[model samples]
Target: MLLPTTLILLASLVQAATLTLKNSRFNITSKDATELRAEPLSVTEKLSSPLKLDRTDILRLTFQVVEKDNGNNVQPHQAFLRFYDETTDEEGIQPVRVSNTGKGKFELNMAKPPTSLPPTGSAPLRVSLLIGSFVHSPLKVELFDLHVPASHPPAQHTEEASYHPLPPLGHTFRPEQKLPPRIISASFTGLALAPWLVPLVLWGKVAPSTPRLFSPHILPFVTTLALFEGLLFWYWIDLRLGQVLLYGGILALPTVFAGKHALASIGERRLGLARK
Candidate 1:
């Protein structure tokens, strides 16, 4: 009577509740701990699972089920998998309807479908497992903190067709390696002083309000350009921007250049070296 209804209600509630914030009752370890718990948003509450894209790479997801069963013994069954992203919905996330074959410890030949970087991070190309409208586990496949060279499909050429341009090899910088607050504040202090220093060093005539010569907005824009973009270009050469001193030096280049030009323009006028 009420018992059957109660079980169904309980199961549905459990299914809807989010899971990632909770303790992972089951342990999911891999040969390489490159990707840990990353799941699709829809089923993120059910399971924090990993996915296997290449036919050879293995997917190992472990979970804990309630011991008591209402009707069927809780066993792994054939569930539909949808290769989808944020815009994709429950209906749209359906798999390409190809065969998994599920042979040899569940070997899969699925390709990691295209995905956009997350709003806050680059952890994309996620994976999820659906179980009767109850998508259990979801996993986010991340190669590593260090960017690895990704392989692309071979180009098709018939001698007449134009060759397609290669994708950008932009690497992600880990946020964990950001400068500490004290260091960041000190760095800003230096960048703030750049404009005035340029005038002083070149012409030896400091502006009356040299400290506050430029508008406030200019400082942050110059500093950000100096720090992030400069560092990126510096690292594109494959230099280890991870180290503190080297990274700082690389980022400082743009700021220095800006200040230098500012000096030559204004400083020369003050020194009577050139026209204002």
Candidate 2:
């Protein structure tokens, strides 16, 4: 048990080691492969002068990770180059590809810059290196400042104007139709109702006898027919077609049975008179 405890303590100490960089360097070149600027980078200090680049320039950086205690090469789980613009507060992070031997390389071609590069203006961007690992302490080193040409404004979409809110709608309606004069309306109404008087006058003149109208056999049929007429009148006045149809259907069953019975009774009475 004592030996196991000692080994665990040794392992923890090894895992807590700090990381550093070695042989770090960067260079800028023109489109024709002419070396424009070259410098060795220091892990503890920043460059005194900011780097400048043109539209067709290329920048290349190389470095190696190592343990601070023994100066032995070591690979970190994550390595990134960060570019930040102080004036705009915009930052971009670009990953650095490192090999198993801790050698890392990064390249930026201004002709076709990566999307991770932040938008630039007159102000220079602060450059920094970041290294992180689960087994080792994290490391961050300020590298230098960079200046590039100002970026052009992004192009607008052809239909971008449609995205804005539309103006409030203004509706126009014609005035309500004017009604005809009251006297003319009254005259037309009277004319329409004048024909109904003919039947009433004929009814009064004939005074036809209807002794069986109130009889139980005939009363139901007559009442059902009168109700049917009343239902239609109600429909014209206020009730909808659906209401009229419903009431008429409910009244129809009785109407049919009553009509059948009344007809049958009249036939019997006629037969008796004929036999006598």
Candidate 3:
């Protein structure tokens, strides 16, 4: 009972550890000689204390953009967050593009921190918002919140720090829940083949002959299998839409031919038996 209880408590702590931004507000826009600009607004609390980060933590950032006017006259504006080293005055990490997430909201994630840095006593990082373009009407943009998970304690110094590739952006793993190979295979099979079921059944009923549930139409079967293999290869190689469609069309031709021939063969067999 003690072991199980301890495990449950550990899991709860893992889920609850997250650091969030406390202060965020939009300031005024300015113009210098040629074009207008919006100064980067400070989002986090003052730099008196160091922000803690865990090795396996993901940085979650949220932004809100409210267009002052709804009319088409207002030109589009782009916003981005730049992370900089306060001491060195350089880019601390890769800049994240702010994307509109409907209903006057935008969000960005630092899925993986570009590189690990040496430990610092004071807040060593600062973030700023950059707006690209002149705005006649005010576009109210502000960083809503920022959150990072609290996990493995900060390392003592630069020599011992190590960072691994981050897991898929928003996924968390649990120890007790078991996922086996057979279950995974079944899931993948269901996902891949389920979409064709209704259409395949309808095709079988409307065809000239009773369709063969499993007939050895050698050529068509082999062709369809090869085409499917090619499709999978092309998809994994490039993961592009054009190539997927090209291979999908090629795969579809062989599949249709196989189905039609297989059904015809089954129909012929049934008719022969009926005459006998």
Candidate 4:
């Protein structure tokens, strides 16, 4: 009957409508991450009514950073959004860098698989400010102007296309070379020693008051360096150059140094070692 057809049409229209979020200003606080000594601000939007959004839909977001501090103007500003993914355990992130004109707008084409909504759908999405040294300014994110359309091009097939690595040769075969046992052995040896050697270098060079084995800074530095190296090795081994990782590694070294300082400061505070 005509009733069934009308119902289907209504459903389709409901599925295709765009979603706009309530705008609000988020506070950057040191209470959450006192050790980091950096202001990381986040704003999360939990839909009042769950909308049906396909994985391929694009999101056009318009927002502004209304800095509360007076006369502390920085020209260029960079931010990142940590979008919550329903499919994976890890959240997906995209960079939002723009000239500090107080207001900015950008579009995220959900072409990447990681940014896609899960088969079950996504309920909430988060957009956060990741700039480390923003001088702890309150950010006003205006999502009232968000424009999301349900119709997007279907995601590309994920199956990898096959290609020959070598050119065709006339009846000539080259045996695949395997890594020598000695080199493999050396690599394994270095993997174990390298992490420890970093701490040893820090101990000898920095020469902290505490013993190297028991130093609070040693554990944190070693752990952080190991994670950094692991990520670098993983990316390079997969034939991928991670520029973000490279920059992060450079930034993280100073952060690790800062961690040592934080630890010392905390200890001094606890022991009432404030200077007169």
Best by lDDT: 2
Q: Which pairs, if any, clash in model 3?
A: none
Give the clashing residue pairs of candidate 1, or none. Answer: 19-45, 38-139, 38-140, 39-138, 39-139
TM-score of each: 0.21, 0.59, 0.26, 0.28
Q: Give lDDT tens digits, candidate 3, residues 30-74.
A: 122222212233434333333333434333343444332331221
**Model 3 segments beyond 4 Å from truth?**
1-50, 68-76, 92-95, 99-111, 115-123, 136-276
After superposition, the stretches of candidate 1 with alpha carbons farther than 4 Å from their true spots are: 1-58, 64-72, 75-77, 85-123, 133-276
RMSD of each: 30.6, 6.4, 33.2, 38.7
Give the total clashing residue pairs for model 2: 0
Q: TM-score: which is higher, 2 or 4?
A: 2
Residue 54 in model 4: lDDT: 32
Q: How many backbone clashes can be found in candidate 1?
A: 5
Between candidates 1 and 4, which one is better according to TM-score? Answer: 4
Please give the clash total of every predicted structure, in order: 5, 0, 0, 0
Model 4: which ten-residue window has the lowest total lDDT? 20-29
What is the Å distance of residue 70 in model 3 from its true position?
Answer: 8.0
| lDDT value for model 4 | 0.47
